[model samples]
Target: MGKKAAMQKSKQWNVKGAMRLTSVFHFLQSCGSGCLVPFLTLYFRHLGLTATMTGIIMASKHLLTLVWRPVSSILARQYDKRRTVIVGSLLSSALVVLILLLFPSAGTKAESGRCNASQPSADFTDGSDFTTLESMIIPSQSNVTVYSVNHTTVIMEQPDDLNSTYTPTLVNSSSNWSRRAIRYLRELKEQQEESLHTEFLGSLKAMDAQHQMFFLVLIVIGLWEFMAAPLEWTADDGLYEYLDFVDATDRHKGVTVWKPLGTAVGNGVVGILVTSLYCRTGTVAEFYSYTAFMILTVPTAALLPLYIRKRDRPTSGGFKALQLVHRNSQALLCAITVVLTGIASSAVSDFLLWHMQDHNATEIHMGISLALAHLSQAGFPLYAGHLAGFLKYHGWLLVLAVIALSIQCLYYSFLWDPWSIIPAQILAGFSTGALWWSVAAQCEDIATPGTEETLIRLFEGLPLELGSGLGSLMAGFVMQKFGIKILFQGISVILAVWSITLAALKWKIPRQRRINYSRLLTADTGEISESESDQEKDWLETAMEDDNQKNNWTIAKS
Candidate 1:
């Protein structure tokens, strides 16, 4: 009795601790994301890369993330989720620090000084005697040859002390011919200086060997990012898993309310900190500080699982259940929606900094914009979740997402000032926050028992990986070709078409007929017992007999 009571008390302690730990973990993770991710495009631009190149780099990371999704899922299952999160967070942080150390800043103090001192001198003199001026100017109309005896090409200046009788014999030897020639020489020298400056500036703008090194470092960073992709989804999945041990009401409260609330607070705090740091020191210094914070938080995040009991760890099924998830239609459709949502979100979040910066937004404005968006994100999930419950069809929640996205696109289309962009994020926040909560809950609803983590990861990671990857690439190309406004318009159109199609499909099929969880188990698992099979057959036969009886009754009445 003593041992049993101790075990029960331990379980109670774990339950309470797990809830708080999940919230704290999400908060820290989001803090890091808010500080670094939104500014990445601008960071690349700071490093002298073009929009297309920045997109390519971001796309590469997402592509690697897609490749890593399955691997991360397996790793999470094979080990503790806490272990996976810890290692991934630490490695990602280390890579960020390494990248900063490996690559020098794009514009260094010495290089700036060199660029300044390399300016062409205004006085065009070679400190040579002008007695041979007549020898330098050809008499023929073919060409004027200015020879330099010491290999120093002197500018041809007409001597003001030249005797009026000593007119030089030259082509078109008018009285003012020497003056015209001197004027032409000065113009040529000025042109050369301008060309030199232009070349120097172009060199600064163009990608070179150092830029290639930066690109290579980014690829390495992507590899590190691949490891971190599963952390967010894992937290959500783990929380849902914890719900199995707690009251059902906590599921709604924990997921919709607490999780987003924590994320909002973290994002808001980080936004303020980022704004302050960026205003004082600039982006590079701010990035370094953020990375340091991320590194320190990894250990804090790792402490979560220590408080979680073994019974609270997420259950995993073998590879067979993993295969079963793919055949589940509800899961498939949910995954597709998530993918589309990811594409839309990535296009905006990844490039919002660049978009606002184009409109002359200061760092403080950018931080406030992101903070406000996250705050909206924090507040809306519970309401959106409640609204989803109020509506008969959960699928309509997606339609709401589509509407929110459309509003954001419409608002951004007309926004000419940076601060004006902040208000648009209200829609963005609702769209993204709603989609995230809805997709997770929907995936949980459809997940096979013991395969919850696997399905959640698939639903969360795969769609986001592919959508964000493709979206970043597309956004880069579109923005480069047309502009930011056109890109948002195009995204809006695609989303409109997609949402219409989804709505039509949803309308055609009643929600009750959409997914039969028992059917998923029987069709996928092949593990039904004899009694369960017998019960299924009896139920089917009874339904058929009832249909026949009703037909017979109708005939008799007629």
Candidate 2:
């Protein structure tokens, strides 16, 4: 009996071990993805692809998610969640590896240096002297040496000694030829700057053979990602269900704390890896390394389902999920808010690397900025539930989120250097964390009957797909035409307007009590004992009466 009891206890502990394993899985996945995906645009640029093309590629992933999400849900319902997760992880990893193997070349460091050299200098203007342009274009410490000998300009490799002697050449000492040469050089410099700027804006001409290959690779990856979406959903649903079963408090902690904390740690780890890799091996090689790391670890998620208890699978249908959106006014409002926030946040996230590079940030600084943003993002959600309580209403949290977003945008617009953007991520992180947390609660409160998880997924996914896709598409065009600074300013203005609209709507709308399983099941289930039936009937009647009274009050006010 003692041995049996010990065995039972050991089995229980082993089952509980799934949670810790899942957390580690989340951290590793986040670290791998965070390192590569965020900097993909910069990698595209390195391959001579324009910003608009990069945006299109990135946007395609989200668009694919929009189409694939419902299918993924259905698959999860049809099969075991673990199998789906394993299949998705394997496919995604394979695709990443394939992409890495197909790349033609990581552009050489010298070529990248030339591209950097073409950028307009800080003091460069139409009226600036040619000497300034020359100084920038031909750095004194460069490996290539330039000298004039016997009326011919000879470019050669630099010798070890800076003071190496060279023959003198005389040019029309009596004429204005030097002035004409300077003018020509200045014109050439201007043209180079213009060409680089156009590339930055994502000109069509930038799509050479190599870039076209990358574009095709991205499309294929997007398809694989779409297919894998269901696996992620399955994993998330299983984890949540398990947490709800084992420890009710942990259900809340999973999203509000553990997930974000894991993400934070992942981001920090990835940031350091990205910096080290970028500095040593360049962007393309770094991506290959990232892919290898991801492929190695992603399969470990398959082991997770073996330990966790499986719950009854939820029914899934695309149309059924779609119908939930029209169930209530609050649901519609929540959808709109989520969509708007997605647009604002997606633009910031997709273009962050470009913005940092434009401001001349080094790999280390870029890593630090990303890590700090994620840390703040993780830390803020811990206080979100408390903040909602203090404000006496969850709606107020949305308002605060808007305020934080506006401040972040404003700060981004004014930033003159890369490091400055790091501190600004605090507001960005807080706004994102608070907004998502409140949105989840709001969606849960307004979920339709028999569609709680489905409605929540829709609420989370639709806006995420549409907003990020549209935001990236629009940002490419806007940044091309108006520049990065103006892009942020415009986003700020739009956010300000959105905040005002949200405030007005919040006051006009009425709040409702969240529907719980007990309330829903008790009301809907038939053939109960007479006393239980009577109790359920009484509860339903009271709820109807309250709803009627609230409706009448609203009508009278209107």
TM-score of each: 0.68, 0.71
Model 2 CA lDDT for position 425: 77
Candidate 1 clashing pairs?
Answer: none
Residue-pair clashes per prediction, in order, are 0, 0
Shift of residue 5 alpha carbon in model 2, Å: 10
TM-score of 2: 0.71
1-558 per-residue lDDT for model 2 (tens digits): 999999987765453576667666666656656656666667666665565766777678778878786666555655655555555664575465456435654333233443343544322323433221224343322344333333333344456776995443334523465445445555654565467555753443334445555566576668657655565566666666555455542442453344455445545555566556654555554455455555655656666633344555545433565655565556577678777777877778777677777777765666667777777777776677788899998877877788788778878888788788876876755687777777767756655544555666776788778988888888877877787788888888888898888888878876655544556576653322223344345566788899999999999999
lDDT of each: 0.62, 0.63
The 10-residue segment with the lowest total lDDT in model 1:
107-116
lDDT of 1 at 457: 59
